[model samples]
Target: MKLIIAVVQDKDSNRLSKHLVKKGYRATKLASTGGFLKEGNTTFLIGVKDDEINDVLDIIQENCRSREQTVSPVSVMGGNVDSYVPYPIEVEVGGATVFVLQVEQFHQL
Candidate 1:
């Protein structure tokens, strides 16, 4: 058995969960936060047989996509002033970080 841990953006969580359930794969979703962006995220825990690993991965790939975004730097402008930039910069966002682990045992009651 394998444990698939997928941490996806909050916006994509609903769609991903729906797709997983539609494909007859059980998943547990938890509220989480991203380390880099410090944004809201959703963590999914799925325990599946070895043969089904690819299927789970396919669903995640289809649902999670990375793109560019804009953000502003955390610095003062106009010298020794407590003012920030009026506009934000662009950066990359919207992706999934996944991890697959071997499970020694799995039981459901």
Candidate 2:
């Protein structure tokens, strides 16, 4: 057995959820936030057999697409507030950070 952990943008979560269900894969969705951009993200915990790993990966790859986005920096409330100027920078977002791991045990209660 294997566990597939996929962290994807909120924009693509719905679409990816649909695809995963249509392919008969079960997943647990959790609301999350990104560290860099502080944007909403969805983390999916999927458990599947070893042979199904590639199919789940392909589904994630097709659904979550990385694209450019302009984001303004968040200002911190500190001494440098007077000199701090927030600037919008182009960043790459909307992609899945996937991690696959081997499962030593599996149980359903």
Candidate 3:
């Protein structure tokens, strides 16, 4: 068995969830916060057979796309007042961080 942990941006979470459902994949969703962008995120705990790992990964990759976003570093991530830049910069966001782990045992009740 494999445990897939996918942390995706809020914008892509809904879409990803839908896809998983459509494909008959069950997942446990958790609300999470991102450290870099200080934005909402959703973490999915998906348990699947080893053979399904690639399919789950592909679904996550296809849904969570990385795109450039303009954000003020100081306002969002925070910075020293002395070295604050009062300008918006383009940064890439909207991607998933996934980890697949092997499960030694599985039991559901």
| TM-score winner | 1
103, model 2: CA deviation in Å?
0.7
In model 3, which regions exceed 4 Å deviation?
A: 36-38, 69-91
Q: Across residues 1-109, which tens digit of lDDT does each residue of candidate 1 receive?
A: 9999998988888999999999999999988886833489999999999999999999998887787666665532557455667777666667888999999989987
What would the per-residue lDDT of candidate 2 be over residues 25-69, giving only the tens digit for each residue?
Answer: 999999899762348998999999999999999999899868878
lDDT of 1 at 70: 67
lDDT of each: 0.85, 0.86, 0.86
TM-score of 1: 0.75
55: Cα error in model 2, Å: 0.6
lDDT against true structure, model 1: 0.85
Worst 10 residues of 2 by lDDT: 71-80
RMSD of 3: 4.4
lDDT of 3 by residue, 16-99 (tens): 999999999999999999663357998899999999999999999889978888987666555467756667888787888888
Displacement of residue 3 (Cα, Å) in model 3 is 0.5
As a whole number from 0 to 100, the lDDT of residue 18 in candidate 1 is 96
lDDT of 2 at 85: 46
Q: Which stretches of candidate 1 lie over 4 Å from their true place?
A: 36-38, 68-91
TM-score (C-alpha, index-matched) for candidate 3 = 0.74
Please, what's the RMSD in Å of model 1? 4.7
Please list the residue runs of candidate 2 whose C-alpha ends up more than 4 Å from where it truly belongs after superposition.
36-38, 68-92
